[model samples]
Target: MQDMIFDNNQVLAVGSEPFLSRFDLNGKILSRMPCAPQSAFSVSLHPSGVTAIGGYGGLVDVISQVRSHYCTFRCSRT
Candidate 1:
C-alpha cells in the first residue's frame, strides 16, 4: 500500500499494482502524479534562500551559506 496526496490536505490512495482514479476536494482521488507510478512515502517543501535537506544515504543537500571576504596581514623580520 502507498499514500497519495492531491490538494493541500486531500489524499488519494492506491495499491502496488497501480491504477487510475479521480476525486473531488472532500478527500476524493483527483488526478495522479506525472508518471502515475509508485507513490512517495513522504514529501516536504522548503523555502528559498539558504536551505538544507537530508536524505537516507547520508547526503546533506544545501542551497546557500554565509561567506566572509576579509583579508589578514602578516609581519616579517627586518
Candidate 2:
C-alpha cells in the first residue's frame, strides 16, 4: 500500500491498483473502489466527505462520500 488514512474507525488505503480500498482495524478489507490507474501514492480525507488521491504522472482524483468519482486532474511541473 502506498498511503493510508483513518476515517470513522476504518482505514482507507491506496496503492498500485486502480482502487481505493477500505479496511477494518484488524486489516480485513471492507470495500474497494476504483480510483487512479496504475498507482496512487497519496491519500487525504476532507471534512466535507471528499477523498483526494495522488497518483502516477502527477494525477489527482477526487471521490465523493458515496463512492462516486468527482473529478480527475493532473499537476504540471513548475
Best by lDDT: 2
Q: Each model's C-alpha lDDT?
A: 0.34, 0.93
Report the C-alpha displacement of residue 4, candidate 2, in angstroms: 0.4
Off by over 4 Å in 1: 1-25, 35-39, 47-78
Q: TM-score for all predictions?
A: 0.26, 0.92
lDDT of candidate 2 over 1-78, digit per residue (tens) = 999999999999999898999999999999999886569999999999999999998899999999899999988987
lDDT of 2 at 55: 91
Query: Tens-digit lDDT track for model 1 on 1-78?
Result: 343434335543343433323357674555533212332232222343232322223333333323111222222346
How many collisions between residues are there in candidate 2? Answer: 0
Instruction: State the lDDT at 23 in candidate 1.
Output: 52
